[model samples]
Target: MTPAIPLVLLGLLDAAFSGFRAYAGSDARIRKQRFATRAGLRGLAVGAALLLAPTLTAALLLVTGDQARTYNTLAAGGLGYLLPLTVYATAVLLSLAAYFALPFRASTLAVVVGLGPLTLLRPLAIAAACLGAVLNGGGGSALLVGTIAGAAVLCVEPTVHRRWYHHVQ
Candidate 1:
């Protein structure tokens, strides 16, 4: 089993990146630059909180021995660990595609077709990834799967946003 420290560090990085993305994508801003700086800082704080909180909680749970069995069962195993990562990646990819193929009014049929697979396969993919990780063994494999998934998600965001803005206007 991988040491808890490294896993905690990885989780922290992931949280940070996710928080940054979330903040950058908020709808309240008119000028991207103006809000970007503030959002970035906010994201950093939120990410740190997320990463630290979970790690601390898990550590405490481990010490207390009163840990939630169900969660432990799911997260302790390799497959369980990978499932959520895979699903998250699949969902983000699908959302990106959906956003890019926007102007739903114009491409209603295409949008439906594109989103169809995502809607159906996202959950299954995540589940399978998690299962694969658990069955295969945890460690770097889980992180790799998650990184690849996150990258795929990132790739589509810009295109989707542009299309969405165009459609809105």
Candidate 2:
């Protein structure tokens, strides 16, 4: 398994959770509970996938025994390598909090507070993808997948927020 696959998967997981959070927080009572449950399940799945990824990748490497000389494969695929995922998760959490705390509807402050970190991290997502590609022996496909995943986050998050805002308002 190339390194890009894991990174892209991680990116997609991050975006999925982020989008869920954005969409789930708008409702009240039973709807909120259902949304939260679904979102939590998604998060758990993502976490499990991330935890398994390194071991799976290592197993594949052992099977293939392809010497892709770049960096330490184990280290590259390890938990520490998921810093980008963690950062993205943090940004999503912060955005969700900000979205709740700040007033919606024509409020630039709310949007800025909610999206600032995500915007800042957009470039970092690309950088992480590039790094993952490099570490995985120049599989540009992984980078492309990661980039697309990040773009999905960028697009979906705001739309989720806006939709929820409109619904709530």
Candidate 3:
């Protein structure tokens, strides 16, 4: 419960980035055809995926290990959250680099600017979300749960995009 907000934020970021990528990568013809309808479909699919993500993630984590049951003080959490934090920091740096490259690619900025960097950020975002959940939930077990949940969430946008792109059109 304590980690709920962080997890929600992570899910939101996943959907947003995914949606952006899909839209940018789509065919121009498709983008121009009933654009609003396609966008709405994408939104609905991503929303449904977001709701389903946590349940599947929780089930997978719960059945997989005993380590997922252990709680610890932040001090006791030790290296569990460390690696994730480091990865998240690296992602932030890379994302910054991508943003800096914006001016150079200004022409295509609207279409492809955020695609690679955002895709690259997915795993790192999961790591960051997991660490936040572990600390907030006061348990190392939350680390595993967070990891699975964040990973599950990462698929939301892409899955939605694929589904809607085919069906909505």
Shift in Å, residue 114, candidate 2: 2.8
RMSD of each: 10.5, 7.6, 6.6
Model 2 C-alpha lDDT per residue in residues 52-115, reported as the tens digit of each score? 5434544555466555532344434433334556666676666767677766763456556657
Better of 1 and 3 by lDDT: 3
lDDT of each: 0.47, 0.53, 0.53
Q: Would you list the clashing residue pairs of candidate 1?
A: 78-133, 78-134, 79-130, 79-134, 82-130, 83-130, 87-126
Model 1, range 1-169, lDDT digits (tens) per residue?
Answer: 4334443444444444444454443566576765555444554454455445445544554465545552344255434554465455555556556566767664565445655455455445645654565565443434344344433333333333343333432
lDDT of 3 by residue, 1-169 (tens): 2334444554555455456555654555744646644654575457556656555654454566454354233223324444454466455446556666656566356225444555666676666656655666437555655565565556666676676565443
User: Worst ten-residue run, lDDT, model 3?
Assistant: 70-79
**Ranked candidates, highest TM-score first:** 3, 2, 1
